[model samples]
Target: MSDTLIDPPADGPTERPLPLRPALEAVLMVADQPLDSVALATAVGHPVEDVVAALQTLAEQYDEQDRGFELRHVAGGWRYYTREAYAPAVEKFVLEGQQARLTQAALETLAVVAYQQPVSRARVSAVRGVNVDGVMRTLLTRGLVEEAGQDVGTGAHLYRTTGYFLERIGVSSLDELPELAPYLPDMEDLEDELERVGGFQTRPDEQPGDQPGAATPTEETP
Candidate 1:
């Protein structure tokens, strides 16, 4: 009896290469802004901890390189940026004619929405001291604001900023929104504007918070 021996194929699975931390670093190093661990994890299909460790390692390497740029954690994530010392030089190349100047109406509407997200058009109009229908359209079209949804009580469409806004402003989320106090007029000064427009208020004697009518912006990127 002649017995023939057959070769068996490979086992259950082929081995894959381990995750390369340096590759992850290279990807993030060239990004315009910081990347969150979640984003990195998704890209590499690895645990967030792994991605974070890789980022930390890469950051140190860049530091040791003494390049004109470094990694920084901002808006609840990490991003590569030019060294502060090279700001002037970098600005000359990146900021030339690339700056976007928001219109007054857009700014006002954005301010209202940023402060009072999920706010309705009527509320924004109430705070701006003018009809905001047109301005809301502009903000939406410009990708600065979007419809959050309908309010149960009035069924009015709620509005908020888009991811584009977060990226545009170099923030990870609305929580990172800048404090409006410095940019906003005081309650006493805004009284005329508020009364004339007829919007909600945080307190009888204070401006509304960053909510529909009252709240504040903090660094809580999602």
Candidate 2:
């Protein structure tokens, strides 16, 4: 064999492309949010018709095969969801895991946020009487809490319990969040605690209980 140095072609392919279905699955697996047809098509470098067909076929195959997870199209987008038939198993697994793992402090912090949503981390910390940054990050990572908005006065990011949190707790709304309030001090004491910590006291009237929307993630990501 002759010794030689080779220069690669600059304009040719860099890597072998994945087939359409595999590519779509790969993208959806990593997606934290639903992807619409146009996005999926652009990603897989396929036509929209082909993408839609592949998605439908995949959905049917999953259904027929009785898979634990499924491909679903909702709110003008497509994503992977736990198969409804398997939700109890998944929920049991998740709730059991959560119960085993979440610490007492985390549970307390979660309760604070649950009862006082759109709440700032500062407020949660003040309520808990300790800095809750790390614990809050854990909650965020576990999908138990999520950024709702920001405090208009201080600009601190506010967070709320996610739909996943509600699902795990077996509640349709915060109104049904039980056992925390009785253990907490009376409203007068709680208001004093808020005032002492320079935090806002979330009003009961603003709890969104009356409107009680399902803590459902079917339409969007938590």
Candidate 3:
């Protein structure tokens, strides 16, 4: 028999499975926030335990090599971050010619709001010892905080950090926020003060005698 080569059938090219480390890297490189092992495993079609081990190994290898960026487990998940030593460089690069960065006062207020969410404007002001109405508006405009709901006891609108805030900080959840000393004012005291102060007082545009849940007068037609 003559040695003849047969042509392959034309349906589609065969797809090869991706290697573990490279596949994980590719998924992580584009991630907008930290990804838990379960998510990474599902994406790579691998076991969760195996993904966890792989991530640990990758982190160790990066550390050994003194890489500028390292794999870090943060916010209950894994993500790559520039080493702390290089933060200044990264900040400079990101802020180059960018003048719209949040001010120091806004950042402090944001921190308080973040740590004490579902909080009222009065509570925030009490904590910071200053009026935060304008700063709160700025945070709202920046999409960092949003109205959670009105306090049942105080009738004051409560605020909480938004998902956009998490994305901006590269955290998966609020639980990942750094721990702080428990020096915040007592919640009970704040509530009591709010109750005594008439709780967020009605907006200035409302009628003097208007009360919450009250019926509004209708216009009369001729």
Measured by TM-score, the strongest candidate is 2
> RMSD in angstroms, all models?
16.3, 13.0, 19.3
lDDT of 2 by residue, 136-187 (tens): 7668878999988777755556789999998987889878867666665443
- For 129-205, candidate 1 gives per-residue lDDT tens digits of 55565566557656789888776754556788889988988989777877873664443465455444433332222
Cα misplacement distance, residue 210 of candidate 3 (Å): 16
Candidate 2 clash pair list: none
Q: What is the lDDT of residue 219 in candidate 3?
A: 18
lDDT of 3 at 133: 63
> lDDT winner among the candidates?
3
What lDDT score belongs to each candidate, Candidate 1 first? 0.64, 0.71, 0.72
TM-scores, each model vs. reference = 0.38, 0.47, 0.43
Candidate 1 accuracy as TM-score: 0.38
- Candidate 3 residue 53 Cα shift, in angstroms, is 71
Residue 25 CA displacement from its true place in model 3, Å: 57
Deviation in Å, model 2, residue 171 alpha carbon: 20
Q: Which stretches of candidate 2 lie over 4 Å from their true place?
A: 1-10, 13-16, 102-144, 149-222
